[model samples]
Target: MSKEKESVLEGFKAFLMRGNVIDLAVAVVIGAAFTNVVTSVVKGVINPVVGAFGTQDLNMYSSCLKAPCETNDAGEVVKGIPIMWGTVLSAVLTFLITAAVVYFLMVLPMAKYLARRARQQAAKEEVQEVMEVSELEVLKEIRDALVAQRGSGRNDPGRNGPGQSTP
Candidate 1:
């Protein structure tokens, strides 16, 4: 292949091999699967609870938008305009249920855990900083003492001070 073509292919391969791309693909697959579960829950559990008051299926509910709204033998709209508000209601309920489940079960717990970890990390860093400062203070004290000792030695009678020549 030409170098240009080869470079393009290599770039595509590198993009596909990236961790974020792989993670996104995995998330998409898992999300699709989770959606099915949520849909089933809405249809099976939520619908039945609402059914106690009216129709079991939310899709069955509707209002006549125009006059002469009628259904044929197969329950298909054969006459006037009908607004399928029940379907919209069902979709809204499904979305709310999904959001609640994701928030309470996943987002909330993760947020709490991250907050706790952050607090712990901050405390650890504070302790480390204090220790470093203590060590630095000790080092400074040691350096001062060494300087004092050297100065005293120079002042002694046996030791040469500054530029004085030893004869």
Candidate 2:
């Protein structure tokens, strides 16, 4: 009934508020923005450099099975089924560039940073352990000293109390 509906809405609210969901949402938004930059670089810089050596646009390069691909204002098919190999090549190149940038700029650095943090945490733990061991050693020494005093009768309140002199 209405109780089930309320539970479902509460579950949905919890899902939306989860840290992973929020992180994923942020990452998608940032990725979209980054995609635009990468696309611009591919179109503006990389494409032009590649075009200098070959065709003006890589996307324009294609293969026609019918022999003639480009036609001059004819109502008929210009060429065979044009397989746009150039566009595919362009897409592949863009993918490679994006992967390389993300790896080097984000993933690799994040991995290095995480490793460094882990090392630091390990070192801090070691220091704490050493300090704890030293403290334990001091505590044992104090305990042993008190035991020795008691055995020697110096710790006895009646025999060698702080205010009374031993006869």
Highest-scoring model, lDDT: 1
lDDT of 1: 0.93
Q: What lDDT would candidate 2 get against the real structure?
A: 0.87
Q: How do the residues 1-167 of candidate 2 rate in per-residue lDDT, one tens digit apiece?
A: 69999999999999998999999999999999988988899999988998899876888787788777666575445556777899998899889989999999999999999999999999999999999999999999999999898787865656765556866
The residue-level lDDT of candidate 2 at 105 comes to 98
Give the TM-score of each candidate.
Answer: 0.88, 0.82
User: Over all chains combined, what TM-score does candidate 2 have?
Assistant: 0.82
Off by over 4 Å in 1: 156-167
Assess each prediction's global lDDT (C-alpha) against the native: 0.93, 0.87
| Model 2, C-alpha of 103: deviation from truth (Å) | 1.2
lDDT for residue 121 in candidate 1, whole number 0-100:
100
The model with the greatest TM-score is 1
